[model samples]
Target: MPTARESLLNAALMALAQLPWSGVRMVDVASAAGVSRQTLYNEFGSKDGLARGLARREADTYLHGVDRLLAERTGAADRLVAIAEWTVGEARAKPLLRALLTGCWSERLPVPRPARRGAVLSKAPAQRRADAGLPSPADLVAAVRDRSLAALEKGSRPSRTKEESAELAHRSEQAVRLALSYVIAPVGEGVGPLVRTAVGGAVGTTVSATVSATSPTAADRRRLQSPV
Candidate 1:
């Protein structure tokens, strides 16, 4: 079962899917989660803080799923394709994720334009370097990767070599961006086939080739795998 905090956060995110962030009050989330206003504030501090945490959690979940797909025993190419397909498919399925990506709720709320941008660009230096650079994307990714590796050890392949990590990370990032774009932009079914093909090529080259063809320079591989 989810903790009280987790339940509140999920309820808040689900409400966000239905209403613009500007209009999404803490009370709404509290009501949805069967909690009180003080409880929400106590747990999240402020509306912006709650929003930030929710967005980060969602992005982390998506990338974690990609990590799992990449760890499967399939060939690198097949694994790459699987990751792309799963990403795009999930983007199609999760209305809340799409809403969060596009700031769809903004239309209904009075939020300033900048906050919407911040939500989408969660990895910007400003957001990533919060708290005077106390913690970084490297820290978050390491924690997530460690957990993912422990899960993969159950049946999937162990961690990859430096080259493989670079390849997978490059491809995974592109796949994530493409999925976000598709979710927000809403290209029609007519364009879906073309988009898929283009994204497939893009993801394959951006990530797979980096790992499969030649080992990148030690420095470059380290940078790519660092997740910063």
Candidate 2:
């Protein structure tokens, strides 16, 4: 069963499907969630808080899916290809996700104009003030890229040096950015092959160089073989 917060967030998303964000009312969301307006306010504080909560939930959903894909697939190339395909497919299915990822809102989405002074003064975390508005496109892109880098690092063979790990992470970030570019504005060509080739080539070259430079000790081999 959904908690009060989750229920309210779901109600907001359901409202968004039919109404623009600016037009969505807290009263309506509360009613839809089978909660009182006061409960909604107590849970989310303000409309901005509600929006941020919804965005964070959606981001977690997408990232969790990416994590699952990474675990199921073997090889860096295959995993990268799967992630690209999943992103494109999810973007097509969820308008909100697409808007968040590409920073391109359609007519269906409410136009998020600048907030008024009083609106900005609402009781929310000072650090979350920026999130009170729609997240910047760059911020969204960077968040996804960071997740990609982390996933790549987790799957990579243990690096002998920090520099090697950083290089691998950099390559992963680049591949994610490239994939996102296609997601934002497709070029009428398959992105899977392109991303796979680029990521696979980079990983192969990096691992080969690392291996040639220094062989893994017996302990290192055992650690690599151990289940994570």
Candidate 3:
């Protein structure tokens, strides 16, 4: 059987999913978990503490997927779209991801804003400092996509024909931007899926060499020739 602490945490996570973190209370969590408020207090110390734990538990899951995505040799544009789509899926499902997408938990709960402090505000200051060298999640995903695309091009051609360079770069930039817009902060309502789909389309166009011969597309293609 789960311990009272585990039960309370699980209840807290569920409540956070359905309602804003601020709307959740110890009494509600306790009631949902079939435990007493006192038990919750004894285990988590405060509402903020419970909220922090819940956020971390969810983030752990998110990072795992991101890590796997980065490790793959998928095309750059595909990687960007995959990251955005993954983010959208998580935001639609996980409370923590939704909180990130909605930017609600930062207001109600004590969850750390990654962009604000560089480290998840919930993490210790030392940890944040240590993580400062790493790119933001959105940026990291963009970089990975950029690298993967460049790798694909290199392996396919001894040297890119000038025409190919022009077309590919244009589409790749659009695709990366599309992915970043959805994954990053201030994600407006109804924009997530739209941006992801657009990114996917952009990737398809670029990878297929369907873009017109133009300077813009050429630049975008060259940009994809490296890790962002």
Candidate 4:
């Protein structure tokens, strides 16, 4: 069973599906959630607060899913590819999530803003968190990049130095940005190959650099050059 706040948020999403934000009424949302108008206002502070709450949940849910996917016991490149594909699929399904990730909120969607500088903060912790500024598209991309980098780092070899870690972060961002590109201007093909190319190429480059630097006196320089 959902809590009152959850119920209200769910109700608002349903309302949003059928009507534009301008068309959605507080009373209707409260009624749909089996609550009074006062309860709605109490829970969210206002309709704009509710919008922020909704956007917060959307971002939270998406990031949580990305974390879950990244937790799989897969190679870094495979994991990045998996996350990218999943992100594309999820963005296509959820309008709010698509808007949150891409920063392309349509007129029908609630393009929520943070609480004003001097506005009274909400008493509820959740509401307060929502009132805090939401992530921009760049913020979200950097977040996903960092999350991917962290996950990949955990499963990395012990021999990986700080330079390798930095390279890993760069590769992670490339994979993330490639995923974002698919979300923005998708072609017919899936995102897997492209993400793999980004991350996989980075892996080879790191290996080749590590080998060449470590084995200057090696007889087979061609083998040290590495392959994708």
lDDT of 2 at 59: 66
* Candidate 1 lDDT by residue in tens digits, 1-228: 886678787887677668777778788888888888887766655676566556556656766786777567344335545654565677567654444444564354322222433343333343432212222334433443443334323343455565565445544444445545655676665333343354344344432344445555655656788966
Better of 3 and 4 by TM-score: 4
Q: Cα lDDT for residue 175, model 1?
A: 44
lDDT of 3 by residue, 85-157 (tens): 6666666556455554444455544464333333234333423332233334454444534554565466565
Model 3 scores worst on lDDT over the 10 consecutive residues at 126-135
In order of appearance, the predictions have TM-scores of: 0.53, 0.70, 0.47, 0.86
* Candidate 4 C-alpha lDDT tens digits along 36-110: 999999989988999999999989898998899888646666777888898999998889988888889899999
Score candidate 3 by TM-score against the native. 0.47
Alpha-carbon deviation at 159 in model 1, angstroms: 17
Off by over 4 Å in 3: 1-6, 17-20, 34-39, 70-73, 101-177, 183-228
Off by over 4 Å in 2: 106-136, 155-163, 201-228
| Cα lDDT, model 1, residue 67 | 70
**Residue pairs in collision within model 3:** 76-149, 112-121, 166-217, 166-218, 168-221, 169-220, 169-221, 170-217, 170-220, 170-221
Which candidate leads in TM-score?
4
lDDT of 2 by residue, 45-139 (tens): 67867776776667668878888887797665567677877888788788878877877877766444444556544344531453446556666
* Every candidate's lDDT: 0.54, 0.69, 0.56, 0.82
Q: Count the backbone clashes (under 3 Å) in each candidate.
A: 2, 0, 10, 0
The TM-score that candidate 2 achieves is 0.70
